[model samples]
Target: MRVISLQPSGDLTLSTDAVKPSPRPNHILVRVRAFAVNRQDLKIGPSVKDAGVECVGSVEDAGGVKGLRVGATVAVLSFGEGGLWKDYCLVPAKCVIPLQVSPATPGSPLDPATWAKLAAIPLTFLTAFGILDNLDLRKHDRLLIRGGTSSIGLTIASVAKALGAVVATTTRDPTKAPNLSENGADFVILEREGGIKDDVRMMFASKETFTSTDELSTPALSTTRINDSAGADKCVDLLGVNTVQDSLLALKGPGGICCLAGSLGGSGSTSFNPIKDIPSGVYLTTFAVDRVDMGKVPLQEIVDRVLERGEYRLNLDRIFGLEDLDKVKDYVEGNKARGKVVVVLPNEL
Candidate 1:
């Protein structure tokens, strides 16, 4: 099998001599078609190791798994052991969601372009959906998605909007606002040079002051109250400690939930005084995609929605081949793409 492994020099090396992975009793062996790059891949440092987290492929062997069959198209979320960037990879049966590839039906076909799009969804969509699910999002609720231009951020905004929530997203670049808005953000808050917290507060203040009755009635923002603060019903904080305080401050008081789903900014510890940082009655929670229960993910519904829409709306910033592993690493490390970067594998060895 061909695999992309991290070398001792901290660079990814594609080698065709890699040993093929076999399926466990409860796992399936998949012949990967395409896989998406994620920020987590950067942490797989200087070691000779297989290092991908998600892919879309076909089941080469079911390994006695009852429901899965050979040759079935599947999307694999490699949480237990992160390595799907190869010709053959082992995936737990529970993490393998069979996809329908019929355009005449309620799903997408496994064409090259569609496979690339499907590759972009698993980890990103699952993480976003898990966060929103944890927050117990409701119709007409106002959601503030911090770091809205990132892949998961964009997916959260789109999924939340599809679920009838009025989505407000934050981006450091004002130029990305129109794109975010087109992707389902009702409001785009530009992070000011030095005062992101104040800028967020000001944006919410404007929402409170000028938001219309029709807007409030259109499953956008109803008269929802949590304590006395007039702000977002819930916030999806992807920037971690760097922006969590501002996220709490932008919520609609005590009943609001802030889901800390990522540390895209930095993972360093921060000092925060809860009494001063968190708003009264508000709740803070953390979500990790790998920690989420596979049984609880609405995989079928998510796929159905994507197919029904007839297109994958999440942006594909770039698609690289297996040979470009080093370039992919550099591009991701440099944060050069606003959306998901995928690696499409050749179907044959």
Candidate 2:
């Protein structure tokens, strides 16, 4: 079996002589068909054996798990564990999500195009769903997604739109505006170095008029003064701590929720003071995949929405074979991908 080996010097190499893994009790051995190359893979330490985290594969051995049979199509998630960058992956049954067998390709793996699209779903879509659930998003709400070009960001935009929210997204490059719009972003804002709060305010202007208070005359103007100009009803900040404060300031009013979902802008600490930085009546929260409950995530429904019903678009940017691992890193880390980048294993493997 061949697998991506991580060297101590923080480099990766394809090792062809590796032995395939066997499933333990309550575990299933999966034959990986395709895997998504994620930005989080870059941060993985060398101590981890493999170099990928999410994959779409077939069950080789179901380990007697209820309702799981051999050759069932499934999505495997290996977050905070051994990765799935090889011919076979050994994961606990709980980590395996059984997908609906494709009617066109029943009892067999999906076509290359379909497998690649399915590979893009597990991690990004699940994380996006968790973030939106935490924010308590409602239909017709004005939702803003900072760093919208990311895979998870794009997924959020599509899913939110399906749920009837008016989605607004931010991108650093103006050329990517069309891509965002095609994936269900009703409005796209160009993100500047500081933030997009001003841009979001302009797009989602408050209907109610308020008199601007004189700074010196008020002696102690409440943070509500900022809310007077706030616009977005909710925000999912994928840019991390650096832009979360800015996203918070763009809320339409008090009680607006802002969820910090990604660290695409770098996870460095920010000088955030709750009383001084967080707007009055605005709530700031964080969504960590490992900490969130996955039971609430409608995995089958999400798959149906993207693949079956066409309610959502899986923004699959590019597909690479196993041999093009180097190019995969370059495409994702260089921020060249506007959405998911997938790596498909050859049938011979």
Candidate 3:
């Protein structure tokens, strides 16, 4: 079997003479089809043997797991345990979510293109779903997303739109504004080093409907003035500690909830005093994928929404081959990929 190994000097090496792994009692053997590259993969230590985290594959052996049969196509959401870079992986049953692919040929593997698209969904979409769940999102709610061009951020925006929320998002690059708008963001704000509080407030003020004073009930058509509390009712902050305070400033006070989800801007330490930092009656929370329970996550529904129903777009930036591991690392580390990056493994292996 072949696996990508992480060297101590921060390099990825393709090793072909590796022994194949077998599944334990609650695990299933999966033939790797494609795997998605994430920023989290870059932070793994040298002690870890195989490097990939999320992938889509065929169930080679069911390993006595109920509802899992041989030849079933499944998405592997291995947060950190399963070595998904290899040709075959032994993933725990709990981490595996079965997917239904309507193929032209029965029981055949999806084309590499479909595999690449599906591979982009698991980690990013699941993370967005978990964050939205934490936010207790409601229909017609005003939702704001920071780091709008990120894969997870895009997913959050699309899902929030599907749930009937009015979406607004931020991006550092002005060129990426159209992409954000196309992906369900009703308003796209160009982020600045100073902050986006004034821009968001200005947007709200300029677009007020003047029909009512209840801005919280209808932010899209609120009559609230710019000087008033014109801000997003719910916010998903992906920029992490660096911009959390700014996010708080942009949020509607007294009842708004801000969920700090991703660390795209780098998770540096920051001094904090909740009494001074958080506004009165507003809530602050954090979401980590490691704390998510697979049984509770609606992975199957998310896949259906993105792939089957066409409710969400698959934010696939680029697809690479197993041998192009270095290029994958460069694309992600350079912060060039606008969305998810995936690597498709050849079946001949």
Worst lDDT window (10 residues) for model 2? 221-230
Residue pairs in collision within model 3? none
Tens-digit lDDT track of model 2 for 1-349: 9898655565668988888886677899999999988777766463646778788888999887889889888988877785788889999877888888474567654788888888988888889888999899999999999989998899899989988999999998999999998888999999887777888888878655445556665846523323364589899998888888999999966778999888888879889888899988889988888664555557888888888888888888999997787788878878899889999899896
Per-residue lDDT tens digits for candidate 3, residues 259-316, read: 9988888879878567899877778999999888888877778787877889988889
Q: For residues 82-105, what per-residue lDDT tens digits would candidate 1 score against the true structure?
A: 877789988768878887665443
- Provide the clashing-pair count of each candidate structure: 1, 1, 0
Worst 10 residues of 3 by lDDT: 206-215
Q: TM-scores of the models, in the given order?
A: 0.86, 0.90, 0.90
Error of 3 at 126 (Å): 0.9
Kindly indicate the candidate among 2 and 3 with the higher lDDT: 3
Q: lDDT values of the candidates? A: 0.79, 0.84, 0.84
Q: What's the ranking of the predictions by TM-score, best on top?
A: 2, 3, 1
Q: In candidate 1, how many clashes are counted? A: 1
Model 1 poorest ten-residue lDDT run: 206-215
What's the ranking of the predictions by lDDT, best on top? 3, 2, 1
What is the alpha-carbon lDDT for the whole of candidate 1? 0.79
